[model samples]
Target: MGTTAYERVLSVAVAALHERDPEQLWPLLAADLPALCGGDALIYKLDNWNESEGTLGLSPGVTAEFTALGDEDMGLLRAGYPLAAHYASGPDRAPVTARRVAGRSWSQSRTAQLLDDLLDVDHVLGIPLPRSTTPVTGCMVYRSGRDFTDDELRLAEQLQPLLTAVEQQRQLLRRLDTPSQEAADVALTPRETTVLLLLGDALTALSIGRRLGISERTVHKHIANIYRKLGTHDRVSTVLHAQRLGLVPTASAARP
Candidate 1:
């Protein structure tokens, strides 16, 4: 019988868990997820559970339609989406727990409506990545019709940590590859460095200013300076540049 369907899925998940390259892993998972979980899924690896800074990476044949999510569209979607609240209400280890009900759940909310209109999704499956102490980064799978069954959710729960380990290791390599000294070459001031790291954590100008005890206007000044020095345009690029320069928070440093 050749190890059965569920067993084969787990085998593939384990085998590719350490692939290190999203390019390799995304397509593999995209192909396997529908068979294993019984729905079309797109994987999102975010910077924080807060839905702030991160790229929506996917393999070649995934939901290319999501490319329509412009800065404004995504801003509204992220701000209104309930991921942060979901993190607060749900158990840390319960990665497969469902948050959004069905189309009805999102029918009432503008955020859900916005995303639903764009992506034609009616349900969400969240896999909370706990490889880090704060438990921020993870993947979410969305679908248009039926919600994922309990059994499928459980399987995803089991699979979360496998991908989590890969991501944590990938971040470690990024940090290792980055020259701590290069961050200094950009000549970011101490306060500017603080802004950069917090920015990487997906903090907004208001949040960053409040945390640093500075005015939001002052915070924007620091960000503009950072952008000018690094020659980056947006938050994602700034953080990516900062990461390459070894400015992003390491797993050890991120742990609370």
Candidate 2:
């Protein structure tokens, strides 16, 4: 892809962050991804984690093109693909290429074998989403005949972080649109929200303390409250869950 294609794709991806309707997010992805990545197909999956129960949620109501293979494909995908194991393991947001994973006995996986027969898929590249945070979302590119060039792979890598941000904001917008009692009960305070905003910016507790005119210990205290309210164990999940609850400020909203 040329600089123009790269720029356009980036613009669309950034726009996806402000998309008013969460449901439109995937259709937008299906329509835009092929042109962006030079791929034959795309798939997106979202995983949600609860303190009580672990969850792997495939975002429903996606357009058929993204899910043309049908719902049963999940079994094949889980059995053959590395998503579950990847989610289970830590350091949550690294991208995994099919080439890197090709050593995983694909021939032995019944689902992978079925997919190969059905799609004639020769190559794939994937990035798990909501970058740098949990609930284990994944986005994958499929090519039927050729391996991804380093350039195309680079493009996927570049877009992964942007789309991860988009997913966070999309979920936030969805929650804001449909007011829920549960979300309401768990909403962060004005102070906690301020701290989370800085956290999303990757600020340290000292920085947040200076910004908020609080001590580092106080910053940590608020963060602990934020985590407990959000049911998140660490900083990244707290930041992401804050984003989902519309507690973190959006990039556009932060600008002058």
Candidate 3:
């Protein structure tokens, strides 16, 4: 793509971030991919960790069929695959991309096989989607019949930061819309709410107990009650939910 095209992509990405909506980001990403590398593109986001679920597409028609491809097609982007794996393992890390694959095996996956039969694509370039301190939340794939040029690779690299910014903005929007457990007006003792707020601030149980002049076991009991009340299974979800309810400040917003 030309410098003008790259500049347009960056402009679109920034605008999408400001909108804080996934739907707005899709067309910009879709348009930029074909310009950067003459190929159809798909964006996928890691959604379910245990099931290894990732969402594909940009908007309503988007699906996770690409990552669900049979093992063969996955090997072409080994670096991308592992990078996603690592991201799923920890959602607080930045995304990584597999710019190039070792061989033509990328053409062998179910998606590739279908594309080959229908459209004749043979090469793949995978770029990870941007994320905050979480595992790779998503990726963008570029598929074409011919090898990518050096210029195309350079352009993709330049676009990485833009993609990351888009991802971070999406995540922030999600957090903002996420409802807090405390917001349900679920009745809790004053001490329980205090404990929940402290947890949201990332205080350890021990530290919470010390601060509240309670025993650690007592703090743990309060946490257990908080989890049950919030229908949360872990600390992270509880804290995120708490923040959504305006019961706590996000880490970035909290007093130092």
Rank ordering of all candidates by lDDT, starting from the highest: 1, 2, 3
TM-score of 1: 0.55
- lDDT per model vs. reference: 0.62, 0.61, 0.56
What's each prediction's TM-score? Answer: 0.55, 0.56, 0.49
Can you list the residue pairs that collide in candidate 2?
A: none
Off by over 4 Å in 2: 48-73, 78-80, 130-135, 178-256
Cα lDDT tens digits, model 2, 13-129, are 656644556777766776677558777666666544222333223323333433555456555554326544564577655555565665656445655555466555655566666
CA error at residue 135 for candidate 2, angstroms: 4.1
Could you tell me the lDDT of residue 56 within candidate 3?
43
Q: Model 3 over residues 1-256: C-alpha lDDT tens digits?
A: 5777767775765566445344556555665555554546554444432233344454222334444656444433332443445555554343223334334444454445554553345554555553333444445454555666666666666666666655544433344333355563765544566677678767999998766556999999999998998789999998897766675567887544
